[model samples]
Target chain A: MGELRLMKGNEALAEAAVRAGSDGYFGYPITPQSEVIEYLMAEKPFERTGMVVLQAESEVAAINMLYGGGGTGKKVMTSSSSPGISLMQEGLSYMAGAEIPCIVANIVRGGPGLGDIQPAQSDYFQSVKGGGHGDYRLPVLAPASVQEMSDFVPISYDLAFKYRTPVLIVSDGLIGQMMEKVELFDQMPRITDKEINEKYPWATNGKPKGKERRILTSLDLDPHKLEKHNFHLQDKYKQIEANEVRYELIDCDDAEYIIVAYGSSSRISQKAIQLARAEGIKVGILRLITLWPFPKKPIDELVIKGIKGFLAVEMSAGQMVEDVKLTVRERTKVEHFGRYGGVIHSPEEVLEALKTKIIGG
Target chain B: MSEIAIQDIIKPENLVYEKTKLMTDKTLSYCPGCGHGTTHRLIMEVIEELGQENETIGVAPVGCSVLAYEFMNVDMQEAAHGRAPAVATAIKRLWPKKVVFTYQGDGDLAAIGTAETIHACNRGEQIVIVFINNGIYGMTGGQMAPTTLPGMKTATSPYGRDIATMGNPLKITELVAQLPGTYYVTRHSVHTAAAARKAKRAIKKAFQNQLDGKPGLSFVEVVSNCNSGWKMEPVQSNIWMEENMFPYYELGDIKVDGKLLSK
Candidate 1:
């Protein structure tokens, strides 16, 4: 029981960043996520926790700032919406290649290009798949509630530093704008410069007295060396997949049908599950906490237990359904349901979708 | 002539010059006679001379100097094409006490990275920006760059640059000097011994300003020649640059202590 407060998802995240002992935050304002930087600016985290907050010229500059700060073995973060995150792809790729540790929170909006400033879980492909060019995958954490939004900040930093890789927290307008009770974590002191040198010897802070100079760059012009680096990155992704898969199974023990979802969709499906059970349908919800490591093992276990079908609910046209299908592999039928283009689906709509698309279909 | 002993010539008192220890033993990837090597040496020398060798972090930009991290050797990070300034901005802001600088070329500093460069300078980021203006994109086989002079020929401008179609060459040093955030802005050349000395002095001053906790960004632009990119001999390229490039780009201080110098 740390301090409790009613805070918007974006505000909670900003407060959590300060409490997480973040050294710096560089971000550009975007709809549904602008509150993040606005809150940080108004709160004056620099005075309270020595966290440096800057409003960058653009999302492009913001992500590069993360690269620079994170390369120095500092815990830094940034938040943006869809279009802004798209502008950040190149920097993110470079950071991924260079193995810099940082965190990015994408408060998703409807988009192919400037779609709308409403809730949408449409970036599934971009988040799980490599949004940026090159062969790299960022660890994607999908926070379904405002509480998870606040809690995921420290978890993201921990995973980022542990793997020496970028981590992403994907939420949306619903969670970002909605106010909810959040139990805030206690403030952790920012790591001292000496501690950073000791912990991250490879960081590009400065050359220690007699130590070898450090160089952090993604460019290895030699084909063999680049290939070797790629192999090393792949090995890291494999380890993350093996150990970091996270999900929550609700009322899944006696489920005949399961609704697979994450983020806001998972929250909606929880309500839909309750409705379906009231109507004598044995449906359960599978809420993914980590979108990247996809939680295939749990899905496999459900399939082995004779679950008939899966309905992948989302706020997109149908993205995560692909992953669910790939994991189910025709052993069971998997279908997709959603109201896209910034439309929010109701619990009744989800229940109808499950009955029509999976149970009855 | 008397035979000189190797030991005598290499003696401590007899040695007039030696490579700065700040630079690593790694071989530079720059082409023969490229000004990048000279500029790299000058920056490292300044850092070493200031006793800030272990207290500095450098952001290396893309282009011929993308491999600058391999040679200069202090803790360094390689930035994307034109984002060195943005990268350097975060480093300096996070660790205000640490000496931070960005090494960028014309294409990186003036063209693709113009927004980052301008905004960083405008925001008065407390860092040094070492801009290398070589007129053409040397790393990508002589492509037309933002700083490419009118009528100059490059791989992309095989028939000579058409000013109306290609746009006028950007005088970025002059452009940045107009910004209030810049504490010191200067333009120099490194083609001759005297020019190299002046350029070295400018670099040292820029680094010293950051160490002194100056209020704004320090910019040092070094107009250099790319002989291989220009498809000319090293000597011919230097001579051509003096005749054609110097009159347009000019030389000497453009701004000092946040005040623009009058023509």
Candidate 2:
């Protein structure tokens, strides 16, 4: 319970993690996401709340550290940018396969390779789908504003623990760098030693009983066992798909056209929605909050309602749009528009696209 | 009165586990010849001997050992493929009194995880590292590994592990011993009873080093064999590992600080 204060999205994310009773943070300082570590370093949450914060050698190490921390059922997380996240793929895959609960925040920058420090949403597919190898999905949350960064951090932690799976808080350079007012939640008291002992009977701290030895590995020499594990993971993924979809609708009740967007791109689309309304154009905005869950229900509802078409605005060339199209099932036309690399589209740019495709103004 | 006293006898079975009896009811999926099973047993022995069954924290890595947390009867953490060192570093640093260790495979420790592993050694993080070197990626269908010897064949290296193309083999035990933070470094194969017994001793000291307050990074390499990946009978694979593998990778404590055992 605190008053609203100006903060960067990444910084708010760090503070939110501490407030969520996170026990450890392992991260490499990459641009855009660098502020996340800077906030942790300056605040020293480890000393106050018994949190372990370390600036790892590389993104690879940071993600691995998260693997270790999450494996033991400790609230652990790591934050990075595009290139750094790519390095964490192996660890992420293992975390998913091992069923270790942890949080990962990717403050995406534009990149096919070494793109730029600027904002880019090209990592949409990577975040929503399995960013790493193997058949699994990391539950991904996309924050539209600085406030959502703080809000989503705790939500991601809760989801990770509840499902006993990994969760991704995926933002872009724009949201990470932009400053906005965020309300800091009251820090919750950490679980006592007694509670941890009773709660995590599955975690291995090392004593062997007649009960089988516990292993946090993803490997199985036996094909039958491996298949069984994969099937279990597939079940979890389906459950997440069924349960976790979320989105925001603006002016859609009277909207003749719907604009689909997410992350930083959604913010720009909000402006387009306002401008179109002023000109008496019944244009609405559908901003996706959970990227992996992909806001399918609201989208399908709109498609069935006979909404003319959607202009998919994203920082990537076109990733989420494909999902939108597939989910819409050819019911409505979905036009794609985006920019790759470090360049982010302006509100005017989105408005221009809307004017041509939706308004004909 | 004539009945046997229930509590008087030193019931080795009675001292079964610890306060944090964090064990999952999951059966192991390791193959008959996989080194993961034996190495895991050796660790349990050390845990039992030290009487730190509950207070100890085990860090599992990304390879075959990733699910180690599920089978070990203790509080466990899972580290990324090679990030076990860093995770162990943080866990130990945050909870200085707790015993922490990392269990990793060759691909996890020597390949992508090398950066974190080396840095953790350099930092002298007071933790134990049980390095399992099976020379191939058993989990990923027998792909090449960092420790895959020159001329060895794997799925990725269809012809053989060509030095010019695949790069030099990684030696973590030797590489880690060079770090000042390292208190003990030893390489032992699990093919024979002799080697497995010696391995138990090496691992025990590694844990003892942490308990003594002289925080150090200890490395214990268990040269294990993967049956499914090698496509050989368990017995034949063990023999092959002894004759061909042991020569290049000699077994013994390369470094130790406490009571000296004659080489």
Candidate 3:
């Protein structure tokens, strides 16, 4: 419960993990997200709390380290941006299939190649829709502000343990590079390994007392056995979809215009909402938190309320709009707004779109 | 031999069944003459002998060993391409009392995972590493590995890896041993019975160091040949490893604090 202090999003996450009594942190330093590593190094969380702060040889090594830590039922985390995150998808997929718990943070940037290191939420599909090979989904947390980045660090830790699956803190260079005030929570009074151990007895953490050894893996090569595993994976995804849809709704209850956005775009949507309100035009905004589950229920609710039509704002070319359309299902006119390659959309641009659409409506 | 002594020692076949079976089964995907099978057996033998089958945690790297978790008869974690060291660091930190090690290939360990491997060695995290140097990529078809010999050809470098362009092979074992944090570093091959026996001992030593709660990095790089990828017979591949590979990557325990803790 420390007083509010100005801090960078990446640094705040590093501090939050330290406060949560994490035992290990493994990561390769990448742009924008490098602050997370730098902060851990400066704080020497390893020396202070027996937290293992290791600068990995590459992003590949850092994520694999997270897999090791999670296998042992330890709290582990790693951070990277676009290109680095792409390398981690393999390990992340394995974690999901094996049901290992860990936190992976991606401060995304423009991509498709060696995209610039500026702010871009281009990794939206890579993070939420299973960036890696195989059929899997990471419970993605999209944080729009610097404060959410700090708060989500601990929350991701909790979610990983709760779900026994990898949790992603999907932000952008904008959030990681921006500075803002945040209230850092003191270490929770109650923290123990026994709780997770007792709950997740299946954890290969160690040989369970006298029980048989547990294996942390997702391979089921046998046609029948592999089908069972795939079935189980699909069932888990269904559970997640049923239980974990999250979003922010603004003024959509009585509005004719609905704007859909997330991460940085969501930040712009908030401004658009303000502008629309000031102009006496009714504009409701829906910002997604759980990007993978897609927050479809909220959109369905919006459609039910007859909240005008929908406008999807994203850094990439209309990727998430697919899910938005599926949710609305032609019940409303769903328009698409996207910026591809490296360019990012501005709040002004969103406002201008609103002027052309919502205000005009 | 005394009856007590004989009874105390467990056999290799009995090492992996029953409880530790959870981590491994009959399924396999490695090619014939692949030393990965033998290495996997050796690790299982060590775990069973030390009664660490339960407490031991193995981190599998990308490559042929990516599915190592599916075969190792213990609690296993799959790491990204070369990031076994990083994953091992996290597991060790979270569960300090448990034993942790990473099984990696030349490409995964020497190339893609070099960052995690180097830093883990630098910090001296008390973890063991099993480095497999087969000289070529097995999963993505035959490709030049970081340890690929000069004049070796792969799909990427079809005209044999020219030192002028691709550079000479890297001796990762010696490179890692140079770090202060590395306590036990060795280079061994499974080319012959004698070499295989020696390689087993080296792998056991690496595992033992982690168990002794020693503070350092222990690594063993096995110089193995890829018969299918090399397009050579199994026996010829072994000879190739002995003649061409050994001259470059020498074998022996580089560092062992036997008196300090052994291994």
DockQ of each: 0.92, 0.39, 0.54
Candidates by TM-score, descending order? 1, 3, 2
TM-score of each prediction: 0.99, 0.82, 0.84
Whose lDDT is higher: candidate 2's or candidate 3's?
A: 2
Worst 10 residues of 3 chain A by lDDT: A187-196
**What's the candidate order when arranged by decreasing lDDT?**
1, 2, 3
Candidate 2 residues B115-222, lDDT tens each?
888999888888898998888998889999988888888999989999998898877778788777777888997767787788888888888888887757788888
Per-residue CA lDDT of candidate 2, range A105-177, in tens? Answer: 9899988899889999899888878988999898999999999999897889888977778899889888999
- Best-matching candidate per DockQ: 1
Q: Tens-digit lDDT track for model 3 on A191-229?
A: 457875777777667666667667676666578998888
lDDT of each: 0.94, 0.82, 0.81
In model 3, the runs with Cα more than 4 Å from the true position are: A1-3, A189-193, A315-317, A337-349, A358-361, B1-41, B48-51, B62-71, B111-115, B134-167, B190-197, B213-215, B224-245, B256-263
| Candidates arranged by DockQ, highest first | 1, 3, 2
C-alpha lDDT of residue A342 in model 1: 84
| TM-score winner, 2 or 3 | 3
Off by over 4 Å in 1: none
Chain B structural similarity (TM-score) per candidate: 0.98, 0.88, 0.88
List, in order, the clash count of every candidate structure.
0, 37, 11
Q: Model 1 clash pairs? A: none
